[model samples]
Target chain A: MPIKNNNNEIGDSELVDSARHGDTVAFGELIGRHSDKIYNRAFSIMRNREDALDISQEAWIKAWQRLSQFNGRSSFLTWINRITINLCLDCLRRNKRFNAESMDQIDEESGGVERQLPIETPNPTRRLERHELRERIDEALQQISHEHRTVLILHEFEGLEYKEIAEAMECSIGTVMSRLFYARRKMAVLLSGLRQEGY
Target chain B: MIDERKELKIQAYLDGELTIFGRYKVNRLLAHNAEARRLHAELNSIQELLHHNELDHPLPEDKESFRTRITHQLRVEGEGTSRVPNRIRPVLKWVAASAATALIIFAGVYSLMSPENSNQTPAHVLLGGESIEPEAANASFITFKSESAKLSVVWVDTKSSPVASPIN
Candidate 1:
């Protein structure tokens, strides 16, 4: 049976079942519950607010249409997030952003400039507050190439393995490792620079 | 200087993505090489920073507005995709075409038999019977009878439009 409309107390599983039965209200509730996380994930990938908003809405619509196929193998948010990530990847491929990463590819093949930088012993980010650190990290993410940042997000944030990321990004596992290593080294360089500035 | 491949191998070991032999190789490199050890430490710290510190952003738009947009799109797409079945589509097209053709033929016959046309013949004679006075046919027999039976019996008011009168 469909849950009463606008009821916030219902669990996600119940709402999902009701939504699968064609209850738009239940689906709306689910959207209301998870839109922020969905939007944030999209923003992390796309790095543009308008694109993120568009992708997030598109993801929700797709999730609604494919609700019956969602067999509860993962949580509703996880399932929906997978949809959002796939859409972001599609948008990336459609825009041919990977072609823009050719220079980064050359860098990866040769270990990049960050390879020669000195490795700092102490934690460079130790002085900054958590909020400042997050802001700096986001700033740093925006500076790197898309492929490298994506590898980092997949491995670190989404907890995907190298093979899984390779499949998602449609690259080889070796490429995944290479990009991930480059991304971390680049991040280390950026954070070390921030620390030396006494922030 | 460590080559890029060995550097990545060290990272893989740090991530626990390495097999047992790969791990053993990285362990030996880290134990012997101070540079590899420092690189490993730096990479480990960065991974920890990212793993625990993914930024949480609130939805830029209000919840109600975002939900409304998504629900509106769903409704529009639902209507757009709710199409007629493929098999029934051709049949419906044929039926519509037949109806249109029939209407066109009916209009053409009606216009040809209209009273406004001076060339129009008497209804009985047009049906291949003897030419009868319009009033005489209406007063006695409403049916148009033909010797060769070229046309069936159909009542027509010569004064009014042809199809307005019913068949006898």
Candidate 2:
């Protein structure tokens, strides 16, 4: 016997099954549940509101098409998150190609002649009020390169494993660690500068 | 990247992803190196802030439109792909051609097999009270009468000479 949809009150597995069978309502609920998360992931990576919204919608559409392939191995949101990240990565790569020579001047990897130590500056994040601290960090994140910001977001915010980040970013584990370390180093410098400037 | 190995250890330790051996080694190094300790503290503070805070600033308007737009896009895409596939067009044409040919063959066979459709008498029989020599009549013409209508029918044999021969 065919199972009834039960009025949008279904689990991810049921929604996935129905959506696979071409039920738009079931698919719509799934989108409603995870759209914000997917959008934020895109926004963090793209740093642009329009691009984030576009990537979020694109990811959901892709999820619907590949509904049959969802084997319940991971949560629906995680699967969608990976999709959003990949889209953002492709966007960055296209931009990089267009301005290839500009990124050439920046060091691709960490570890140089000096540690690039910050002079004794008070920790701005600690001293600032909570809301101020949050704003400061978001502002600092916007200043870094896409590659560095991505590793930081994946590791520090999304909390993905190094192996997972490597696979998602399509780089070596060492590169994941390297990019992450460089990203943190850059964040530290940026935050320290913010602290000194009292912003 | 101050002391690349140490920086990696700091990240691994902060993320709680280090092996037992790695954790112990980093722990020993952390107690001894001021730079490693400072770096670890800085990274840990950052992680703490991230964990406690979120980067999202979504408007209610944005949230509502996300659902509306995705639903609209899915409906449009669904209608497109569910239509007849181009890949099957050639197969459908072939099937149609085959069906037409079979229909023609069937009508031809049915006409030949039906008694009402017979226009030729047996090769040696006399017809219309004419005493035609068996060989000459067999090679020339034959006639049929529709039993239901009492109608007379005439036919000309094409295998003979071109002169028109009538069946009485």
Find the candidate with the highest DockQ and give its number: 1
lDDT of 1 by residue, B1-168 (tens): 988888999999989999999999999999999889988998887887787788777778888989998888776766775354323545766776665455445644764766564333444334444434344523433443333223334444454443344679
Residue-level lDDT of model 2, residues A1-199, one tens digit each, is 2345564567777777767777777777787777777888899888888888777778888887776667789988888888888888888777773246325424546464225665223454335667877787899899877777888898878878999888877789987888777677667777776556663
lDDT of 1 at A14: 90
Q: In candidate 2, what are the lDDT values of residues B22-137, reduced to their tens digit? A: 99999998898887887888777667656756567562345557787887888887686634333454576577666545544554465457655454333222233342333353
The TM-score between candidate 2 and the true structure equals: 0.67
Model 2 regions lying over 4 Å from their true place: A1-9, A97-108, A119-129, A193-199, B59-62, B83-168
Model 2 iRMS (Å) reads 4.0
Computed on alpha carbons, the lDDT of every model, listed in order, comes to: 0.78, 0.69
| True contact recovery of candidate 2 | 0.36
Candidate 1 local lDDT, A24-123, one digit each (tens): 7888889989999999999999999999999999899889878877889899999999899999999999999978776548855467678888885443
Model 1 lDDT, residue B114, Cα:
68
